[model samples]
Every structure is written in structure tokens, then in C-alpha cells.
Target: MNDQAARLRRMIEDKHPRSDNKSNNIQENSKPEKLSANRGPRTIAITSGKGGVGKTNLTVNLAIALGNMGKRVIIIDADMGMANVDILLGTTSRINLMSLLESDVALEDVLLRGPYGVSYISGGSGMEHAMELTSTERDILFRKLAGCEEWADIILIDTGAGIGGNVLDFISAADEVLLITTPEPTALTDAYAVMKGYSSISDNPNLKLIVNRVIDEPEIREVVGTLSRTAERFLKISVECLGYIYDDQMMIKSVRQQVPVMAGYPESISSRCILSIAKGLLNGHQEKVKLGWRGFLKRIFRS
Candidate 1:
């Protein structure tokens, strides 16, 4: 792992000369413009209004599943203060992303490679400060990540729970927001709250939902139906239901063993559900935000 970290660091420093802060800071203006629209990086953020809805598990497995579809997937542990995606993957990160904001660690120094040949950047505990980037810093960080667009077909950000600034920033900046929830009433309400927050902030109307831990079809329909109506009534927005994953004990067992359920027990019911969701995402079957960085910037800086 140490050797891989060193190699990543060397690769970044040698190729990216502008990252002179030892923190992988790239000069925004100097960045080569995104050349073509030939399948650019698909940034998908997996977030929930409340925690304990298996958001991290969904993010991990989805990324791996996408990798299985022959796409170069990169998962970002964007949870900031309470990240644990590394735990689920059974790998200890030598240099987490917090080092880049706190100390002078390069961004390349922080990424940890995971199973199924996926690369990830750990958000680390106490990364809230990094979330508050100045405009210059924000541009730099985004541009640096944009460089990874060449290497990744999809970038999944496992965002922290709730509607906090970190979560909002992560989701709003993403190409699409994947809202994960269960059939619980509270989860439904929180999902509405998240959509409301998004509607209030930006007009980049693209939010997808994943109903997890389902046991009954009627109950799941009731929950999703309620959410859809609430959005239509208040926010005047709609949520695309990606799919549902049933409550399979194999999910729990895989977590206990620090492996994603998809890889540990691909034949499980939950795994099948996750695969269905992944297919819709990777094949572009669902709606997508048509906005580019300029549009996102306008939304971000709008009054």
C-alpha cells in the first residue's frame, strides 16, 4: 500500500507540475479545457437526508458494479468528518484527503485504490475545513479532479448524510445526485427535505432515488409515491426512482467481513437489485443534468 501511494504521488508530481504546494493544487486557468464531450466523467453523488440507510454500502457496491461493466470507476469518500468507505473495502489508507487541506499532502498522495480495480479518495474525519474552499481553492480543487476525468468513466461521491454545507456542496457540484433511502416515513420526509434544499439552491434539476432495504412492494410504492407527490406539490420537482435493494442478510455479512456485498455474494437478492440500478446509470437510461461547469458556476454564484 505504501509503495502504491508513493507511485501515485510520483505520477502526479511528475505529470502535474502546477501542483507545487505539495497538496496537489492545480492552477485553474492553466488546466487544459475539457477537449471533447466523448463520454466525460460522470460525477454521481450518493447522499441521504438521514444516516443509517446503507448509503456507503450502496456507493461502494455501485462503483464496483460499474467497474464490472468495463468502466473505469472512481469513488470519492466525500463524507468528510465520518467517512468509513475504506473500512467497507477492508483497506487502511496511508494518506487520506484531509492531509491535503490540513498539511501539504498532494491529492495524488491521498487516493487509495480499492477492489475491482477502483480508485478512491478518502474524505477522512475532520475534513469539514476543506469543504469551505475559497473561490480560488475551489477552482483549483475542481480542476485537479477534472484531470481525473480522463481516467474515469464515472466518479461516485459518497456524501455525508443530512443537508449540511459539505453535503450540499458535494451534491450540487455533482452531475447527478443519487438520493438513497429506505421505506421508512422519516426517510421519505428527509428525502423530501433534501430535494427541497436542492430546489431552493440550484436549478440543475437532476435527483435520482434508490429505495433500499425493501421487503414489500406495496410499502415501497407508498413511500416513493408520497415523496413524488410531496415534490410535485411543494417543490414542483420530480425524483427518478433508480431502483430498490431488498433486505438481504448477505449485505450484513459482507459488511462484517469488510467486503462489498456485490463482490462477496453476487447472487444475493440485494446484489441483483444493486446491479439493476448500476445498469440504468452506466447505460444512460435515466435523465441527466444538461448543465456544464459554467452553468454549475452560475448556479453556485447566483443570488
Candidate 2:
């Protein structure tokens, strides 16, 4: 692991302070635990109520950060018409998730290898047509999606930003939802809107919030607290404040270079913030048994 990643592990120990159990065995000097083979991958749908909130940027970097901590990560560009995970990674793919639905294609053929051993499957209009598959085709596709658990300990789905049925389907199906938003009033409002739509569909929704481009601690607190309180008081739903990222110029440079900051600028403050979020995310859920891909697909098809 790089210095930034190592610092992140130490920072997590100082801040989160885990219990002294074999399962929670993350130490400052020792390596992070290898993902357990007994359980399935933890599938998290990363979405936003609106675009240009650094949703995709955060998704790409966070995956690499988590992978740095010894977790296998897979990203799915569920952005449909606006698919760009491959582009962000400076790679191109002719085949995608849709290939499986159209014929007897294997998942290996569609996966795109990103930096830091992170593999992603570009939705590339594949997600747009995923729901249109025939009964048999849909069954095959769902099974292929389920088999994704074999390739990852953590599966991050970058769903398109919106309140549309397609976006909500992926959000509701995943084991957890990480909603991204900025400090803009419109972004916050739309975040609420997405939460409202999601709450109506799933009686029990695991909605997590992450504020991007925050200028200070107070700003993040205001954004996260306001959203969490609003969801609980008005919509009768709870939203977890996963973490926040600071405004950093390195991020812009990384985007232009089509390289993730976690690798391109690991020492940047933004990268440190991302690593912190990754560590907290992993440690917090160590005890929880994630449902994995099969569970995610079951919910996806039912919805």
C-alpha cells in the first residue's frame, strides 16, 4: 500500500477505534484483513439526485482506495446512456454488460480492468436495455450479474443521477445506497426528492449520504445533518452520513488526465479524504453479513 493508504488505516484506528476482536483485526502495522470467501460481496449503489456533484469521480477514486486496503473492488457503470467509467479510466470497451443479455457471452469478456486491480463493467447502454430482456434472457443476465460476486469483495454500482425508474431500481436493489450531493440548494433539494421516491418504494431502505466538494467541516455538517434530519422528520426515513470530501484542485487535474486521484495524486488532501471514507466504510460493516450479488439481483428483478 502507498503512504496515503497506510495513513488512512492509521487515521481510521484513531478516529473509529474498533473493538479488540479477531474479526475486527485491523492493526496499524498489520495488513488489512483479506475479504472473507464464506460470504458474498457487499454491493453498494452509488447515486446522486442530480449530476455534476462529483458522483462518478468519487466512485472511481473510492474503489481504488478500498482496493488499496486489500479489498477486491468491482465497479458497474449503470449510467446507461451516459456511461463513462471506461473513459474515466482511460480505457475503451467494445463489449459491456449488455453483451450477456444479447447472447451467450461470458462476464469475463465484458469486464474492464482499471487502476489498482479494480475491474469495472461499463453499462454502455446495457443497463438501459437490461430490463427489456426476455424472461429467459433476463434470467440469464441476472445470473451473470449475480456471478459478479465471484470477482469482488465490494461491488460499487454507479447509477445515473436522477429519480427515474431505472436509477431507483438499482438503488433499491443494492445492499446499501450511497447518495452523493453537494452544498448547492438545488442539489440538496433533489437529494431529498430521490430519498422520497426511494422511501416510497422500499419499506426498509439503507440510504447513506456523502457530501462532495465541501469547503469546511461546518459546511459538511450542515449538508449531511439537514438531509438526515429532513429525511427522518418529513419522510420517516433514516440516512447515514458516510463521509464527506473537501474541495481540491487535484481532482480536476485527475479528471482531465483520465486518471483517478487515488493513484495519480495519492498524497493530495482529496485522496486522503477518500481513503478515510473507504476505511470507515469497511470497518463499520465488518460485522454485518452483506447479501452480495444474488441478493442484489433478487431485489433488482422483483422491483
Candidate 3:
């Protein structure tokens, strides 16, 4: 195998030890098959209760960190109306998802390669137009996305903020959701609003919190603890603390440079935090659900 594939194999072995053949056989036979073998990548939706909580920043950097660890990562800039992922990566896309939906363009044609070999689909204003697509058109879009399953190990959907129908559709379809928030009261409240809204519609949504722009350890604990407690108490949902990003100047500099901090300043505090979160994801700190692209498409198009 090549170096990257070999490294990925080693990481997977270290994280998920081999089970005995007999036990593995028994487990396989005992469980009902839910996901298809063609369902290749794990879909993760990174969203927030409101905008300006650094959702896109975290999404881009986290994808880069995961890619550095030998995982093939694809980021879908699902914020169709106000897509800035291309701007953030300092790369311009000649076409976006809109082109795919409106014409005979293939998925690969719309994908843009960003820094650190990360591939992304810029939604541009196409996402705003997605909700109005006819049934056949929506099915075509989903099938195109499903074709990406073989190319990525992880698909990060950087969804638009707030409790819009499109945002909820993407979040509900994902295997897991990472809710981003800051210590600001409004941010926290909006985050809670998102959780509450989601709980009302979906059953047992996999929700995790990423506290961004934390100034100190105490602030991290305070924000995470308060949000966790509120989610459990009111929504009856258990919110896992994925990780936190510190308030670092390097992040601002990286943004100005239009590069992810993980690529621009690997040693920066925020970059390190993103690496930690990626490790947490790989180490199975959260539950692994069988939901994949096919299931995601079903959920999205049905709604």
C-alpha cells in the first residue's frame, strides 16, 4: 500500500482492535443490516444555532486536520446563499453545486481542491434554490452526492446557521451533528434554540458541542457544562463535548491569509485543538451510526 493508505490502516488498527473471527461472525449474524455496503463515508454536519460562531472556520480547519491524519475528507459548503468556503481557502471555483443541478455536470466537475488536498463542493447561491427543486431534480442532486461516497472517508457539511428547513434537513440527514457556539449569551441561547427545535422534529439526533473562542479553561468548562445541562434538562438530549478552540490571534491571521490555521500554523493553539477534535472522532469518542450517503439522501429529499 502507499504511505497514506498504510498510515490510515495503522491508525484504524490502533483505534479499533481486531476482534476474534468467531466473535466477529457471531456479531455480524446477530445484528440486522441497516446500512448498505456502498455507503462509504461518514457524514458530519457542522452547524450552529446562529451565525458568526465560527462554524465555517472550524469546519475547514477540522477537515484539514483529518486529511493530515490520512483520512480522505470532503467538505460541502452547504451554506448555499452565503458561501465563503472558497474565499476562506483562497481558491476560486469555476462552478458549484448549482451547475451540477441545472445541467449535465458531473460531481467531480463541481468539486474544488482546497489546501491540504481537501476536496469541497461550493454550494454558492445554489443551495438557496435547492429547496424549490422539483422531485426529479432533487433526486438527481441526491444521486450525484451519493456518487461521492466512494471518494471520501468523511464528509463535512458546513450548513447555514439558524433553524431553517434546509439547515435542519442537512442536520437530520447526517450521521452526527457538531453544534458550534461561543460563550456569548446570545450564541449560547441560539444554540439551545437550535437543539430544542431539532429535538422537536427528530428523534435521538446525535448532537455534539464545540465551544469556540474560549479564553480560559474555566470558560470552557462553564460554557460546555451549562450547555450540556440545559440540553439534558430541557431537550432530554445528551450533548457530548467534542472540543474547544481557544481565542488565538493565529486564527485571525490565518483567516486574513485565506488559509486554514491547521495548514498555515500547525503549531497554533486553535490548530492543535482542531487536531484533538479530529483524534476524538477517530478514537470513537462518539457513537458510530450506520447512516451514510444513501440514507442521508433519503432523509433530505423526503423532507
Error of 3 at 97 (Å): 0.9
TM-score list, all predictions = 0.79, 0.85, 0.84
Residue range 1-303, candidate 3, lDDT tens digits: 233664565467447744533222113323212223333588899999979889899989988888878777888998875667887888777677777675557665676666566678888765556667888878787777665665678889999999975888778878888999999999999999889887787765888899999999999999999999998999888888989999999999999999889999999999999999999889864555657766776776652
lDDT of each: 0.72, 0.78, 0.79
Q: Candidate 2, residues 40-92: lDDT per residue as tens digits?
A: 78889999998888878888998998887878888998888566777678876
lDDT of model 2 at position 151:
58
Number of clashes recorded per candidate: 0, 0, 0
> What is the alpha-carbon lDDT for the whole of candidate 3?
0.79
In candidate 2, which residue ranges exceed 4 Å CA deviation? 1-36, 102-104, 286-290
